[model samples]
Target chain A: MKHSLSSLLLAAVLPVALVACAPSEAGTTTDGGLSGKLTLTGSSTIAPLALEIAKRFEERHPDVRIDVQTGGSSRGISDARSGLADIGMASRRLKDGEIELTAHAIAQDGVCMILHASNVVASLTDDQVRAIYLGEIENWSEVGGEDAPITVVNKAAGRATLEVFTKHFGLDEKEIQADVIVGDNEQGIKTVAGNPDSIGYVSIGTAEYSAGSDVAIKLLPANGITASTASVGSGSFPIGRPLNLVTFGEVSKLQRAYIDFCRSAEVHDLVTGLYFVPVRTAQ
Target chain B: MKVKSTDRILVWSLRAASATAGSLVLLILCFLVLESVEGITRVGAGRFLNDPGWHPSQGAESEFSLVPMIAATIASTIGAILLAGPVGVLAAVFCRFYAPPKLARAFRSIVELLAGIPSVVYGFWGLVTLVPLVRELAPPGASLLAGILVLAMMIVPTVALLAFAALKNVPPGHLEGATALGLSRWTTIVKVVFPSAASGLGVAIVLGTMRAIGETMAVLMVCGNITKVPSSLFDPVRTLTANIALELGYATQEHRAVLFVSGLALMIMIVLLVFVQERLQRRARLA
Candidate 1:
């Protein structure tokens, strides 16, 4: 028995013994924020966009590599406010009086209410949209669509898109029943497209980004007008909101360079192509 | 007729005790029933149990299956056990059989220190260290390897401490009997010491599994937060707790309900595991 126990001990220790010798990288890159390096996190909605801008800036100035991660807008703002991140990105404007980080409006984005392309819904009134999201309108036939229940697709808490959409549609303070909480834009769309009776809101940019993909979801025109930059800029789309790149009150030279590049025409062109309205230009 | 004084007091206390206990159980039951009503209604009993995909948004059919989440939870916890179980048991053995008095005391102190460290700090370390390591070693990097590795590190102290305490309780007389039988040191430990403590070790394993399954922060940091089943050692994976933490804040109605369903499943699994441990203990004693 003693020998057996000893053998068991050896069995457990062997694998762990092999793992204790984990290697560590020995070099440090000096960059813009702190003396050693800078890391940023928060907001998945803007993370991909931020990555593109960060890559462009890093190439021009190789001294700093700003690492970004996505949690959500609340996490982004909170992390930046707590000094954990050098920058925070938000698809919606920061809640009033955010003194911790100076706000920078990088671009404008709007929400498009989408359904499966097979669904016969033509458009949704602002009141009908509100009622549906508020848990008042549960069936599609009630809203002149079909005889099916409407499955709501909402963003998870802290996502900037949810915040913006809730406010734009006046669904705040009302009970909204979500069928599922999606972790990312891609997943949210996937959930909506797979269901004929589901309606979800996503950034116009995301819908644009998803263009040419075989997603069966169709964007329903809100207020009887198609959702687009032209519709939004021309006061035709009612659910338009801002896409912002926010950062601390003061930052290092490299961080500033990154910000400048975000406003450049090359990035703006990408934003326009992706269906998001670009508010900045090369000038 | 007037009750006897002792009978009156006993009856009153029983009434009070039962009311409190019964109410507590009822409240919990009510909460679970209300929380899960949508899924229970949508999928009915048989479909909810047998269906796959777990998509609450699948509409008409009412996708309430928990397959992906169950897969993730089991995968993460099992991964953690695989990572922490051996290391912890070995540490306990070293403390019990090999360490000198001062060294053992020091190890005890260190293990206690590790046990006291909060889940958030472990999560932070996982985010900083484990994620990068996983990204480097695995093809995709930020995958299950990182989550498993970090959870193992976080839970080892728990298993080690439990094993050490159990080993310490082994009767000195048993060791003496084995030694008197001319058994070697290894034989005495493996044969005599181990059998006597198997029940305690089982409890230790159960406790470690509890910590591993219920752990939120550390697992959240390294698991990569993807909802898909893991294909490789390094693919990003999401667990039940991570899903709750990530989705709870914004989830409403059915989304919130689904999160609660996952929570319910997790709680049930833990309860069943502990129950099995108790059964095993009973069997071991009976034998």
Candidate 2:
């Protein structure tokens, strides 16, 4: 009787065993003939943009499969340095060591501060923005907005925006707190836009998209310079960053092609279309 | 006799195959250790454990400090313990003493289903709903309270189901013996059945703690990812798993090493828990 029961159990389990043992048919890429999968990691701030670019690029070059992931600026820089990333995207400037690790800059951007359309606060100096992030500036009244309590939203820890803000404010990891820590740029924009008393920051692209909304918010001028394409082009925006494409190998046939494509004047229209400050044309 | 001999060989093959399959875990551990060794040597012991600044962005002079992350891990685990313990124990007691078998089975399945949900799904829900909910409830918004609450929600079903299973496995004979002694239902559960089952319950609670400590997604979405000592439940917090997941993509030699050190901390915590549980079980057996 026990032997029969055991036999029954084996029969029940065998099909499941066979099914699980079968190899996955999904092997990274599909259609045409992409040779090897390319995995790119870094800057969550840059991930969606990277993904969008890859989606379009893959449509054009069907064989190449690209996987884009985000960690933050710190991770992007380190991934590039240690050969973990095929391409690292950062919204923050590289350290001297990181710069020494790589020679070329790929792009430039502005970190724009945004408030809701209903928010009366039109502008803030750099000091006020820093103070707000540090939990010192608590009320909208203090920043020429409403008497409502100011909700300070921020990016996830390890993100490029968070890195830049923390460095700029000189705040310790302990002192930093947000009313809510938004994990992505789109959510960050939506959160601040949805609330009249909230202040948040995102890339120039997000800020522009927000500014163009019917319930649009405006990017406050930092220091004396406005966070504008013009100001960004002329180098007056205090919240400026150099976007980079860091890779594991130097001048790989594929990487060089991609980089050259990105830097070409033809993509200038696309970059501007996305609200990013275009790469400066060679003089 | 020939058929039986063939059956015996089949069973032996099954056992051997399972053992071989299990060895794959050891293989993975070996690979992870090999990959991790280079980074570990670069990040010296002191800097990995002590540095509070997670400043890999600053370069090689700065390294990722796992301290705040470890603190977040401990806080969420402890919070889960505090929040889930009483509720889970009570559910077990209620099921044992009061619930009908039909109701009990349904409840158990529901709890199991909750446990089976993917971590990423929990994280997304936490991000969209829990973060905003906590922010509204707290003074300004992002708080350790939010992370704790989210973790508490995630871990409760796991602990309760384990506790329920442990309680149910208390031998039926023992319950009958208690009733034969003229003990009340609650008294029978508290004094007789529970005493014998206490060790299993302890094991269950510890397992629940493991779930809480290792929970990455739900806590990450709600914790606000602030790497510091939480001043209050309302302060934004960071946890070890969240930090590791958040930064592992970009961390290089030394920074990556420190992350492994953080992982080591987690391994140590789990080992210590299992060790303590065994010790207690040994003592119980001796008694």
Candidate 3:
């Protein structure tokens, strides 16, 4: 009885081992056929935008497949420069010393402060915003709000949102005292909406969408510039950052085609649909 | 002869499977050590253990101290066990002793169902329910207490189930003998039943502690991921698991290596906890 059982198990395993060693067919892409598989990774912000564009690009070139992944902007930059990905999606401008790769601006977004709609304070000066985040300003009354203690919501470490916010505020990431540490824009908005005295900063696009849908969160002006698509497009917002696609040195014909597709005017609507300003509109 | 051959093959295959499991653990340890070598050399193992500062974002001068994270992990685990241990053991006692047979069966099923619920669901429930309640009493809701409460809730079912089984394993004759000695119900339970099942209860406690220490999402959701040693129960602190989960996605060479070191430390701590538990159980059995 056990002999048959062992034989049955062996028969099942041998075929699986053979199948696993077999070369995958979809990996072969002709040099000039525009049918190769492309993997785009990094920047959760850019992932959805890239996904939309990839979907349309796939519709156009039925033989090509583009895989879009999000692991934050640092992952995108590292993956692209290290040749782990065809194109890396980054939500912020590239810093110095990342010269091995070239950044192509595909869209524009801004980091802006968000408050509960019930907040009596509609706008705060840049100094007050900085102080509030740095733990110098502790209560809403200090910033023209009710007498409740302020709940400062900040992003977790290694997030692009935290990096941008810290740089803009002229404070180190470690200096900020956060009441609640949220990972993404939705959580930031949720934290702010749930607490009347809470203040947080997130992508202008995500905050605007949440505010429009009556989620009880509203965007505040930064340094006299409103956090909006127009302000980001017109170069009035200091907190605005480019959404870039980075590739190392010279890209392949297939890579160029995908980059061109992402920058094409057809994606303008999709970019706006995500509440992000188009690169063309900004320039 | 065919039967003998078949039996030998079956035994060999089973031995091979067990060897695979054992080798996999060794493989994991080897990888962890290899990856952590850089971090151990960069910061020196002494500083990594002694220093409380963890500032990996400061480019070259970044510190990779596991002191605060380690303290937080232990503090929260102890806090969780303290809150859950008594409640779980008591619940188990009630189910085994006082409750009717049908009711006990129903209660056991409810606890088993709780054990089946995903950790993320517990996290979400804690975030939505317990966090707000904590916020009302305290200024900032995401504190060590909130983490303890969430972790306690997550581990109670496991502890209760195990404790129930431990108490059930105690011989009926032991209980009957205690009752015949004219001891009251509560005293009989405490003196005779508990001593008889002490080692099993120790196992239950150790398993509960492991679950609490290893829990990531629920504690992360409730514990403010502040990388400081908590001065009070209301203060927010980050655990080793939470730190790795939050930053591993974007961590680079040195940062990644340091996280591996933290993982290694966590593994060592777990081994030490199990060793202590075994010693305690052995001592109790001798007594």
Candidate 4:
């Protein structure tokens, strides 16, 4: 009986041990000689681009594994400083206090106000947008639209879009009276598309794609500059931020290779495909 | 002697399995308390009570209040229960008493199947279908009412299945006695069977409430997730679980710890609710 019980326990534990040890042995050998793993963490805006770049990089090297994680730009800075990740992706330029890290611009993404296609209000001045977000202008008629209460959709804290939107509008994040708070660009677009009275700001790339498609949303021009990938590439868009690959200090040979590949023209199609303007053309 | 040894081994293994299950809850509680210490001490407990808003990313100006979120959670859960309880019970009663045998079985299976559906699917359905329908009636359809309705739908199966079981537990002898006394079918179900199954039905409602309160994905997707006390059913609100789900992905340092504090608050609320339900059940049993 004791023998049978001991064997039963061993049978249960053996498979789990084998599964845990399988990943280390799975690295393929190739002539490229890069066999180490890299972890890049940070801004959700840059994560998709990073994932694509990582995928291509892995195909070339075969032995290199890249893991990309998204937690917002602040997490990118902190994780880079703490050595938790080999590289970090931040959608904004490095702030003054974060000068210790070096940034490599991979792409540019613009933030644009989005409203349901049914909204008659075409464009909003900076002040009008600020006033609407601050709850001073409650009704759409107050902003040259219908006589319905405007629903202000704000991004949740820690999202790069929220930081960029707030900084550009000069509105304090806390002071904005938001009716709905969405997490991602897709969610924001969905919310605005679902409600005619709702207004939200999301990635220009995402909004343009959705608008071009059958989605019932339209991008509002920011500060008289047309909110489009063309304006962003021409550097005429005022509310644009660089999608950066950040490193804390001296990088490893493999990390440098991956970062350079991300900035290179090889991944330009991937960048444009996701609606983000490639840094080479933007510059 | 070999059979005796086998029985001993079987009993010991069962005891070990139960012990592991019991200790895991304690381990989680300890971990939550340990993690939330920094948030509670640095952010100060008073802020959770005094402030009405949540702004975790504002550096020194950050407020760590859980009031609005807790109120939202409680309000939504209660609202969902109020909507789901009677309808679920009645549906179960219909399946048991009124429906044809084949139809009753089919209906019961359908209700059970709803319990198997993932909450994310329900959230997606609510986001696409229900939100737009509500917007036709009230613009900005991602309001508290949408959350309540979605949650009520999600937990209806739980309440219905439990109520069905409770109803089934009513003895054959009681129905026989009611029939012998010339009581109508409705009267027998209302006056005799209902009172006997009242405690079990209460349990079902409490379980449904528990499911609604702990739900995060469905509510987060449907609810507007605004950090404010909803003034009306149409007003958007963010629940405690939704707050944690939305922000914990990027939360760090004191901010991350505060998210843990939110989690601890949820755990405490659920534990307290279960405790209250247990006490009520015991009191009812005693009476």
Evaluate every candidate with DockQ and list the scores: 0.05, 0.25, 0.44, 0.46
After aligning candidate 4 to the native by TM-score, how far in Å is the CA of A265 from where it should be?
1.1
Give per-residue CA lDDT, model 4, range A76-102, as digits (tens). 989888888888889988888899999
Residue pairs clashing in model 3 are A43-A72
Off by over 4 Å in 1: A1-158, A162-283, B1-26, B43-65, B283-287
Tell me which of candidates 1 and 3 scores higher on TM-score: 3
Residue lDDT tens for model 1, A153-248? 666554677777878877752256554445567656755655567788887767655644767777778767887667765656777776666777
Grade the docking of candidate 1: incorrect
What are the per-residue Cα lDDT tens digits for candidate 4 across B1-287?
88777667666656666676788799899999999988899889898878757888888788888888998999999999999999999999999888999999999889999999999999989998888787777767888999999999999999999999888878889889999999998999999889888877888898899999999999998999988888988888999999999999888888899999999999998898798779757754653
Ranking by TM-score: 4, 3, 2, 1
Inter-residue clash pairs, candidate 4: none
Q: What digit string (tens of lDDT, one per residue) describes model 2 on residues B72-128?
A: 788878987898877888887777678898997887788889888887777667655
Please give the lDDT score at residue B40 for candidate 2.
Answer: 69
- iRMSD per prediction, in order: 17.9, 5.5, 2.9, 3.3
What ranges in model 4 sit over 4 Å off? A1-11, A14-33, A281-283, B1-16, B277-287
Best by DockQ: 4
User: How many clashes in each structure?
Assistant: 12, 7, 1, 0
Cα shift from native, residue B73, model 4 (Å): 0.6
Tens digit of per-residue lDDT, candidate 2, span A21-103: 88633223233343445566676656665676677667777667777777777767766666666666776777665655553
Candidate 4 chain A lowest-lDDT run of ten: A23-32
